[model samples]
Target: MKVYEALAAAFVEEGTTDVFGMMGDANMFWMNALAQRGVRQYEVRHEGSGLGMADGWARAAGRPGVVTTTSGPGVSQLATSMLVASRARTPLVAFCGETAWGDQTAAQYLDQGRFAAAIECGFVHLSRGDLAEEVVQKAFYLARTESRPIMLSAPMDIQQHEYEDNGPYVPSTQLIDRPRLLPDPSRIERARDIVAASKHVVIIAGRGARGSDAGEQILRLQKRTGAMLATTLQAKNWLYGDTDYHVGISGLFGSRVAMELLQEADCVIAVGASLNSYTTEHGYLFPEAKYIQIDTAPNLVMGNGAVADCYIQADANTGLAELTASLERESVTIEGFHTQEVRRRLTAPLIDPSEFRSQPDLLDPREAIVVLDAELPPELDLVLGSGHQTDFGTMLFQRSREITSNYGMFGAIGQAPLITIGSIVASGRPAFVVEGDASFLMHLSEFETAVRYGIPILVVVMNDQALGAEYHKSRAKGLDVDLAVIPTPELGRVAQSLGGDGATVRTTDELRAALAEYVRQPRPTVIDVRITRDVLSVPYRRLWFGEDV
Candidate 1:
């Protein structure tokens, strides 16, 4: 067997069924070999989009995503997506081809290891055909354990060499050990004491709380301690409808009432959350709250630069379950944060009632989001894009399931559409990618990839005819907003030209009709909802104009 074929067999042994990437000379042989072994291949328009798709697949499917790229420029194209995946801590294994061995004069000859290191991604070089399976297994092991992207670089020349048959290949799963660490007895007692003593307490959960039964434990703890529930932007709607005391998302996208309640917290128990600057509002969200963090890596100082008073070093599930048990043993049930008045405030509408002046042929983004939220099927996975429009979707749109992902971690736009494609494939369901016009145009060519693959992804473009954030920020500064405004092409027509359905809507009724048509037909569609640029999102208004929501 050739080295490339051996690598393909190793990938299959690791149970990698779905792979995403564009084809190139260096890696085409291995990619073809993998395809021949029944692995699904998703060809993307760009290597960056392929990496984004892999990241999305990892998040949605709860497994390490796989992608392949050729040498040189193909590997360079992964810089941004790799950094984003590293920052988001998404597990992904990328099979990147290096230049031919002993051929520095080759066109694609570049130091792939330095590039991977610059992006903070783990790199493993496959130097020997005999060690191919071991290298592939190590790549998977690192990705699974570190929860970060790992690139396995195989040289083009080496890939063409014959490989010695190494008996049966062992998958990384056998070597990987992930144990749920229980919290220490002394630390649990300390956390329990803090919870019992505080008057108003808030429990903020993050992505780590997902898939661990931590949400249920958190709710049980809430009942025992009368703590209000909130989630970070990544974990939005996690605790929704589970309790009357739950206050939606907490952070820059937090509602006015949620922010107010968070500010009033006398103690905060963060479970599997990083307590980052945005989530804590730059250390001002919980001014008087004693911070207690529970996670595998407990830190003395939080990501917001505040000192944690207590840290329980354990997994979210084991730690929270033990904390709840400890509190229950002491019969600690406080009743201050979950009052009837608080319940009313928690369930109240998040959107501002004040109206913006009506435009001639545009819908208010906020109102349009609420309409779309109501009209779209609840089963469709939602992928939110970054920019000024994200806050509107984050605050207004509600989902019945926890199948929501976003491309805002690195504050990068244009990834949501591609990410939505991977999510749709992973979940085997329809998905809606709520993105701004500027963001949508970034990877608009990928819509053709969706159409070719028959992926059911609906791209809902908030057509504001400009970079909404830059335009609003320039307007706030009394500068020339014209510089930020870019006259975009008709996005609906663009999608239709790419072999997908398209609809341009100017009213809420039109938006509803477009969504209904998508649900009925179930194909790749783009709904260009022209929203007015006159009104600013609540979060943007608060940040730029200091307007209280």
Candidate 2:
């Protein structure tokens, strides 16, 4: 068998059924070989979009996403997406082609390993054709174990060499060990003591709490301790139905009531959460709270420099279950943070009551989100793009299931559309991508890709005719806001030109009509909701102007 064929076989053995890529000379042979073996291939307009799609699939499907790129510039275009995946801890394996072996003068020659290191991605070079299977297996193993992107580079020249058949390839699943770490008895006792002694308790869940029975376990613990519930932004709507004591998302994107309640927490038990700066509001969210962190790798000090009084190193489900059982054994049930006033606060309107001056023909972004949230199907996957509009979408849109993933981890915009396409392909569910006008136009070409692939993704563009974040910032700084205020084409008509459905709506009624039509006939569509740029999002207003509603 040829080396490229062997690599394809190895990928099949690793259970890689879907891949995203754009054709390039260096990697085309192997990509073709993989496709011949029944792997579904998604061709993208740009290499960066392909990587973003892979990242999205990894998050939605709960597996290591696969992507491919050619040598030199094709691989170089992956910098932004690679860094995003690395920082977000998304599992991905990139199959990239290096320049021809020993051909330093080749046009596409680049030190691929060094580039991978610069982006903080794990790298494995396929120097020998005979080791192709082993190299592929190792890349998968590293990506799975580390929860980060891994690059597998093979030289173009070596891919054509003859390879002998080693025995059947062994998949990485056999070698991967996912043990559930249990909490120590002494540490469990300490955590219990902290919870029992505190007057007000709050339990914060993060992405680590998903994919297990952790949600139920967390609820049981909350009920036992009378603790209020909240989730990190990444884990938004996790405890959605617990309305009495649940205060929604915590941190910068949190609502006023949620942040206020979090500030008053006397004891905070963070489950499967990293307690990062954004989640903890830069270490000021829970000033008086005795912090207790529970996770597989519980550290004394978190990313925000907040010290935990107790750290329990265990799986979220296992640790929370044990804690609940321990409390039951002691017959300990404390009326900590559960009060009549707190219940009323939790049930209050989530959006700020402070009203902004309304524009004649433009809708409020927050109100637009609320309308979309109420109209869109509850089962749809939501992907949020980063910009000034992110705060509105994150805080206003509420859903029951916690299947949402944000493209704002790296604070980059214009990735939500590609990510949403991948998510639709993975989950086989309709999706909505909430993006700013500038962000949506970043990869408007991908709308054609979506049309070609027939992916059902509805992009809701919050059209404010500017780079919302920069525009707001420039105005606040008394700078030339015109630089950020670039006029955009009618996005709805643009989507139509790309072979997808489109609609431009300037009011809530028009927005509702567009959404209802899309729901009735699901397809690739874009609803450009014209929103006023004057009203600032709550988080942005607070952070930029020190004003709170």
How far is each candidate from the true structure, as Cα RMSD in Å?
1.4, 1.4
The count of backbone overlaps in candidate 2 is 0
The clash count for each model shown is 0, 0
Best by lDDT: 2
The CA root-mean-square deviation of candidate 1, after full C-alpha superposition on the true structure, stands at 1.4
lDDT of 2 by residue, 1-549 (tens): 999999999999998888998888889999889989999999998998999999999988988999999999989999988988898898999999988988889998889999999988999999999999999999999999999999999999899999999797899989988887989989899998888888888999988887554888988999899898998888888768754688888788888888788887898899888888888888888888888889887465775675788899899988998888988998889887788988887777776535534488898888898889899887787888888987788888876754565635688788888788888888888888998898888888888988998998899999989988999999989999889887888889999999999999988899999999999988999999888888888888888899877
Q: lDDT scores for all predictions?
A: 0.86, 0.87
Question: Residue by residue across 185-210, what tens digits does model 1's lDDT show?
Answer: 99889988988899998999888786
Q: How accurate is candidate 2 locally (lDDT)?
A: 0.87
What TM-scores do the predictions have? 0.97, 0.97
Give the C-alpha miss distance for residue 288 in model 2, angstroms: 1.3
